[model samples]
Target chain A: MSGCRDWLAHLVLGLGAALFLLPIWLAFCAATLDPAAIDRGELSLVPRLDHLGVFLEVLRHGGPGVGPVWRMLAVSAAMALAIALGKIAISILSAYAVVFFRFPFRRTAFWIIFVTLMLPVEVRIIPTYAVMADLHFIDTFQGLTVPLIASATATLLFRQTFVAIPDELLEAARMDGAGPLRFLWDVVLPVSAANLAALFVILFVYGWNQYLWPLLAATSPRLDTVVIGIVKMIGIDTSTEWNKVMATAVLALVPPVLVVVGLQRWFVKGLTEGEK
Target chain B: MERRTIFPGWRLPLLLVAPQLLLTLVFFYWPAAEGLWQSLTRTDAFGIHTRFVGLANFAALFADPRYRSSVAITLVFCAAVTALSLGSGLVLALAADRELRGRDLYRVLLIWPYAVAPAIAAVLWLLLLNPQIGTIGRWLVALGVHWDYALNGTQALLLVIVASAWKQVSYNFLFVLAGLQSIPRAVIEAARMDGAKGFHRFRTIQLPLLAPTLFFLVIVDLVYAAFDTFGVIQAMTQGGPGRATETLVFKVYQDGVVNLDLGSSAAQSVVLMGGVILLTALQFRFLGRRVAS
Candidate 1:
């Protein structure tokens, strides 16, 4: 900013970046190493390249007390995507209804949904688990996704977006005898596409990073998400393959990080704008 | 907040809202009500022979030294995490806000950590902090420091705190940077014209403007530290080394899931739900005033 500030800024930022990357770099290096090498703990800076196959090895066969990495990856993907889309769909609908249509108990219904902000599945996991068990949805995709899909954040965001849409456009749509569904499909959705896209990235990451819900809901080994499996693998009392554990951790983080980086612009926009 | 143009059909709105309402009722309100109810009742080991124990579970929780310890650790954890993450985040944001070379590259590098799941972040730190074969752990040992989180409760707590804060710094950075950038260029120019350059201008002008953002970040980080760090504690320490790292969130899980102490867990959940409601209310109050003015 000032004459002497440039170098200082760069230094500070560079140090921060290095601090953040150091762990991941170590993980990456170890992931490519033989178990014996990792056991030695030299943690060579130079790539060993001897066990590049560890990634596939870990993917094909998981460590103790865990399933195949690919299936865990798929479960993570499914949970993340389902939560994202389900939240977007339900929130958009509810937001549209609350913002655009006046009903008898509209305010009551809105508060009912809004109060959900207070209780995450974490805070109420015991009861939520009981519900899941009662419905026989435990270990099911619906259990992992449905309870998580009702999003106060997205609903609030969509409501703000929908409310910001000029009255003129909706009136114009109505003048053409367009019904509510048609108006939502053609006008509201198209207008809110940016918000929706931004929200998708945010929600996808939120869903992908879920730890406790999947841990509780999916007890079946086949259903264990990577986040859960990583802990289970490391949590076991037996000997842990540090290399594979690091490899699996790498697999666990890569997708969500890619989503954030690939959609960087929208992610920031959604965070700041959605907060407002 | 009324929309001027409206869809006039009541039936359609009802149908549209039904799915969300149903899901909310099924997953949210019902369980929340149940959590509340469970907090009031005590069940035997088998969940049968249930009896109403109004406020007994809560009283017992407060009476229990372990619960108090959990709350104390959570408070301490929240304090350390909020300070560490927010402070580093502010510095990072300030540095990255400059028009230096490759600032965008730095920003991208810093922000991607937000995608790291909390447990994975813990695992990352575990790899670096584990005394056996860890990088920094070896360094610490070489420096004559006894670096073992497994056997030492304080070290375990510190490890979880650092790892938790590390995961959160990226989030705070984004918000802080946005807050910094949102300070109008014209205002900064005006301050600079008055010889309020560098740290003087920032401390006098920019910091006050960024107060609201800082406050919001503090609360956000507090809630994150309290609730969202279950994964980190679970993965890293499992609340071990004599229950040192056991925060309220983890205790809720441990007691409820591992120990099957449903009443205690439910009571704790209710308390946590109260915390969330209070935090949300604080946020909305400040936010509402901000919007109003």
Candidate 2:
């Protein structure tokens, strides 16, 4: 009876995992096939190699309203870079201060950042949009990237990483006539390289996948990221050409997918280290 | 004796914190404060004209039947998604916890769903389940089971819930797997020596230690459901089939963006924020203390 139960459990989990992976596999098949083939449902399970031209067409011809699909790629890449750099720089510095210093309201500030995890963009969209509008930041790069730079998660992770560093390292640097900034650059950051790489990949993925904030803040066509572009292409009428939509979807997913594949090690490391 | 400085005092902290502080104050805090102010007023989409109605918007929202339904739906969605993801994630973590063949492949495949954007996930599912051309719909028809999310509100709600839960299981699984691996194998060996086999070992030795990871995951998943999946709903159903899937965030987006009723949307935002804050505090008070130990 126990053996039978264990087998049943294994079957249940294996099937669930297969279902979890199905949609992503279907998406790849859909993206690769010819539109006619897709409509006819000819290649339902397996993709035909000959129809790979559709992806190339999407890359070359571009989708409706948006220019060449490559333009969207450039936009997403630039935005992701800006968000990653901004988040990391600010998080490292803020984490340094929060970890090392004794200040008035220090605990309060730490808790404030921590609590912001519970207070998400959905809860504060109205005011954030208002600020963006007030600053004339709407439809600009700053509007798209600035708000996301203040990530509580990154700060929390960095603080935990910094706190784990031995105090003697900082003390030794200080005795050697290293200023705090110099010490941070010379000693602290090098020791934290592994954590930094992990955080970088995580932050980059976060920026890459951002949707709502960019949708609200970016009003101009020139500033649209791949996600907003794919969503806009879907159209409220649902009359969008599925071919182009899938093509755009493929485009939007590539960078982050590549990042995940390339930085799989860093991603896992970040997850494990962040939990610690 | 002079207090010798180990590092430069004040300057480093100020510099390190300045950028994040400026951005947070301008973006997060300022908007949060403004949202509070906006909730009590009457305003247009563009904010060109505004009048102070003093809680009238909140009163109207509270009086609306849809708002009441939204609150209930939000709670149900949060609960269902949290339970499903956590439950499935734990099972998968346990299955992969052993020295199985192809374990690495299984782990990779399980986590691949998380790589896709939620918007794309919604779109992919919609295509797979569209009443007319959807693969799943055809399969259901083959099996003599009627399935149409567009006409059936329950079907639509269930689909969204399932999609949200599936998207997050991998993420929860990653953490749970890590937590499982971190358990000292010595403890499990000792349990086995005492004849704590299989379920007994898991329930008595494993589950208790895994509680902290599960607690963190539950809170994180709740927040994601509340905030993140708005894009998915917007993409797939648009809260359709008579507003069955119109979650709190979806309604907030609709009011603010589609309907262009800024004040009411702000009021909805405030209510949602308040609920989340209260729930988080309660979670910390109840579960967080136990997990911390």
Best by DockQ: 1
Candidate 2 residues lying further than 4 Å off, grouped into runs, are: A1-17, A40-43, A103-115, A236-238, B1-6, B44-49, B282-292
TM-score of chain B of each: 0.97, 0.91
**Alpha-carbon TM-score of each model against the true structure:** 0.98, 0.92
Candidate 2, residue A258: how far the Cα is off, in Å: 2.6
lDDT of 1 by residue, A1-276 (tens): 465788888888989999998899889888888777767677866656877788898899988888799999999999899999999999999999999999989999999988887567789899999988999999888888888998687888899898889999988999999999999999989888778878888888889989988888988887889999999988875677888899999999899999989988878887887672
DockQ of model 2 vs. true complex = 0.50
Worst 10 residues of 2 chain A by lDDT: A34-43
Best by lDDT: 1
- Proportion of native contacts found in each model? 0.82, 0.50
CAPRI quality level assigned to candidate 1 from its DockQ score: high
For residues B163-197, write the lDDT of model 1, one tens digit per residue: 99999999999998999999999998899889997
